[model samples]
Target: MADGPTINTIAERAGVSIASVSRVLNGLPTRQETVRKVMAAADELGYVRNAVARSLKSRRTHQVAFAMADVGNPAYLAMLREIQPVLKAAGYRLVLHSTDAVAADEIDVLHSLGERYVDGLIMSPLRVTEAHLRMLATARAPVVIIGSVPEGTRVDNVRADSRTGVRLAVDHLYALGRRRIAMINGPLDTVPGAARGAAYREALHDLGLPYDESLVQIGDFYRPEGARAVAALLDRVPDVDALMCANDLIALGALDVLRAAGKRVPEDVAVVGMDDTDLAAASWPSLTSVSLGSAERGKAAAELLLERLRGDAGEPRVVTVPPRLAVRASTAGPDYDRRQSGYDGEGGGK
Candidate 1:
């Protein structure tokens, strides 16, 4: 049997020297016309480079992996949308992994780095476990973490100042005269959940509001869990005037439950959410939310990984993307009723 196409085959078909084909394929500087001829011939001959052979010689797979809690989460999707373009422009392909925010799955991804299937990885783990720190300390390839990590960890870190993000939402709610504010939060074990819950308390304290244990309901970071938590909160504290949700998905659930219970948003109860994802703006009342800079964090993480892949041996860096509040109709707009009267009635948009 004949061997598959190689640099020699490409050169013979393009009427170029083997050295020229190698230069072109290796992405070394070459004449534009020569590169065009070699690439066209390779394409015509259905030539696909042997990635294993190339990696053995160059120690680079030219592929990057991005591991996140959930691929379908809009916040992570925002990051992926930014991470892909940046990596592609730098001559790399992306591989995605969903860890379900599980520590064991994340550790396995970190361990997979030793196999060298990818050049580097960008991971957004919800909980940074002790095993995570150990893996990050001696990872085989470059890693950029997209969430809070322990101080002085030797990896490029990108963080959303969600502590400040929660503060912004709470401050906005307080400014709107929401005194009996309740929090709809995710599990307290995760990094974001813990940080946001503490921030909520701090923000309330600063506003001269007491921290009421009954005002906080813990749930998972999903729409259904959010609905359950909100329903329970409503049942317990019927007079609660404001809700500071952990993320946009949960806030959406709050909207669903509030609408079901015949509550007028921003009138009977205002809702504020974190992670200002697209759903925040697309919901019936257009939820007000805190922008934790998911896209910016993704872009920054990719750039940092690229720098490491380029042989940058400098000190590990940390980038904290600032947070901003996106105010929409859910919290304070006069035209919400007119714009979304279709979903204003009981059990609407559920």
Candidate 2:
């Protein structure tokens, strides 16, 4: 095996000082003669730049961290799928951190910015606490928060308006003439959970439908818990004509229990989920969903962090990805009252 070439070897071959060779190799402005000599020397020795040495000099790891609540959630995975490619294309490696929706764990991720292991970070905390605000105020590296932050918070932020998303789902249900609409939501303390809950009631009022307590079910954002919550909601509100779920997972769970109870989707109760994950289209009755632009948010967040890393000294920016309703078999089937609707089943365009 042959030994690899080094800067010192190039300096020796080029008959130049190490400093001159370093400046020329690092692309610092130098005399044309020095560039010619260095290029000739590098070509002869087949020299390749050392990334570790370059990073040490430039203080850039070319890596980015993305922290989310869950690794397996389809919504976060959609973001991950988009984020991975965008970072990769920009010559940055992605470091994944899952906080499991724990506030302390999320805070730990926020504090880890001091270590400076990566060039930047993109995080979606379930709940942004006072500690989060403190850490973000003095983050060691640039951060692109993928959730809501306070106004004037100096960080690149991308947030989803789940309230608008929930309203879209409810409006679609109302357009289909499904007045007895129910909601299956996650815990209300979380940002998305609370926004979705409030939006459902507001939507009901807008549609002139009474908001019934029996029609709302509280559950964690997972299959088992969603199923349990839907089962209970069904037991209490057996005549529910439609459902607006906080996320696709809960809506899928609603399908499971509704099928067991012998209610046909869209025919008996049209179901709508939020996040518009891939699972939405794959369900038995393809689930109608609210597209919160997960992919767009991820791509935008990566771009923002990369811009910051590139020495853009402007104040932090914010990108709000709009929501759209995606109608499918679950809400646009034979049972729907087409005569009374404004929109067809195919949700809105991208």
Candidate 3:
């Protein structure tokens, strides 16, 4: 055929029924003899299946979309590392969307579900608005949300316990005699920022430490903003003994300011960050941070979406991954081997 080989050509060459050729080409289970014959014929004919035609017939694009607040964020990058392989193995191509933590951008991504370009979606939104909830409730495709949603939201959800994560980091620093602990956090408008900001206060109160207003500085969750916040906090509370950074990026910024100020890590001041990302280990003193299981959350989201795509009609599920403290030289001092990785309290390496 001038248009190139098709399944019909393969069927004729293999002397098999068109149905057998279709099944073999679509990766469906078929008799070994039939599969071998179909494969050989298709190889000989240089036949290639048309993905668009296949999708139209099967009503599945075999593509999965992942929408996140920030692709460059190492925490989200960790999740991507896990999500890509899982989707790849399942024969689904991955489509990425970076929302930049903007509510409107996130809502647009949710609305795009009606396009049918991707079979399902996994979204991690920093701010979940009323519009977001409404769209999620009526999303056209199977959806897996990677952040906190109100109770009874009808979608598969994988959440990080940022509240507990902050507590773990705060408790760890408290145990190490960090009395003047300050929290450098993102804006309180976002979900993670709100959870972590409140958790830091709760942690300090539970430990009988006074919650000083000057000790809390809010900024965007990025290195430059984090550095600015830390610098501002130091100007106000120069004697702040410990810093609880909302994320690794913020913690790295804290390290930079501290180094420039001639303050020794875990000596003059101890620093702890959340989201024990790759940058944590790569930082100069090796950050002591909280592990909220970014990779695990991504994998769980992918699996949950896959289940939904497989026609699972059960109640929407929610998965919550626990947090662990990853102690390192940033808090444990120079005597602690920098080469040795930190561990979760339950004996798992970070």
Candidate 4:
């Protein structure tokens, strides 16, 4: 086996002392001539810096931890897609930890922040309780939250406007002349679920449509739970013409139930989902979804963390990403007109 070249070998080849080679490798300020010799010798010998030893000396790992509620969620995957590139460009490595949406696991992750394994942390805690607040209050390293933390808390936060997201879904249903729009939402105890539930009722009231308790079903934000919720909602309101799902997964489950019941999409019943995840595009008829800017939010959180690591030390900032509506085959029928009606040049002619 070929042995790797060591710093001593590079120092010998460059005609420099071992200390000078070490300084160059550690990114310490060195004379220009010495740095040039070290670089030339390193390139010739194919010398790679010992990162572990370097980190030990600098007391900085240049690694950041990303803790999420559930890595299986497509929205989290989208966030990862955005976060990975930004962190890489900023010279930081990413370490991912899945908490399985449990409060205990989240708290455990928060406690791990004191270990100093990572330079900073970006977390999306499912439920922010008093324990979570305490952890953030005295975090050793910088922390950037990906979801809503308490107001006036001294931590950078990147949040989604799910209230506006729900309004968009309901307004689209109302525009389609569907009044009995049922909601298949997740458990209301969670942050997103609670916000969406309140928004759904507010949107209904705004549209002059009565908020029917019987038409709302609470699920656990899983496929099976979403299917069960859809079944229950259908049983309670058989005349429901539209379904506004809490997230794309729930929307996919609603589609499954509707398909099993032999109901056509956007014809007999229109469906809308949130998150605009890949599942929405792969559905049978393709689901129309609201984009809660998961990718953007992740990028923003990463940027905030990087800024903090760079000693920005700015005041805690909250970034609210706007949601967009994506209309697709599931909400727009196959023969739906794509063009807007206006002057076609035959106007008022004899």
Model 2 spans with C-alpha error above 4 angstroms: 1-58, 334-350
Error of 1 at 342 (Å): 16
Clashing pairs in 4: none
Candidate 2 residue lDDT tens string, 35-119: 5687668667766345323433456656788999999999999999899998899898898888899989888777756534566
Worst 10 contiguous positions by lDDT, candidate 1: 48-57
Candidate 1 vs 4: which has more TM-score: 1
Over 4 Å off in model 4, which ranges?
A: 1-58, 336-350
| TM-score winner between candidates 1 and 2 | 1
- Per-model CA lDDT versus the true structure: 0.89, 0.83, 0.87, 0.85
Which digits, one per residue and each the tens of the lDDT, describe model 4 over residues 14-50? 9999998887676555664676687778767765344
Residue 228 displacement in candidate 2 (angstroms): 0.9
Q: Where's the lowest-lDDT run of ten residues in candidate 2?
A: 334-343
Candidate 1 vs candidate 3: the lDDT winner is: 1
- Cα RMSD, model 3: 9.6
Supply the global lDDT for candidate 4: 0.85
**Best of the two (1, 4) by lDDT:** 1
lDDT ranking, best first:
1, 3, 4, 2
- Residue-wise C-alpha lDDT for candidate 1, range 1-350, written one tens digit per residue: 07767777888999999998786666555554675687668767766345323533465658899999998899999999999999999999898999899899999999867655578999999999999999999998999999999898888999999999999999999999889999999999999999999999999999999999999999989999999999999999999999999999999999999999999998999999999999998887899999999999999999999999999999999999999999989998646644455554555652
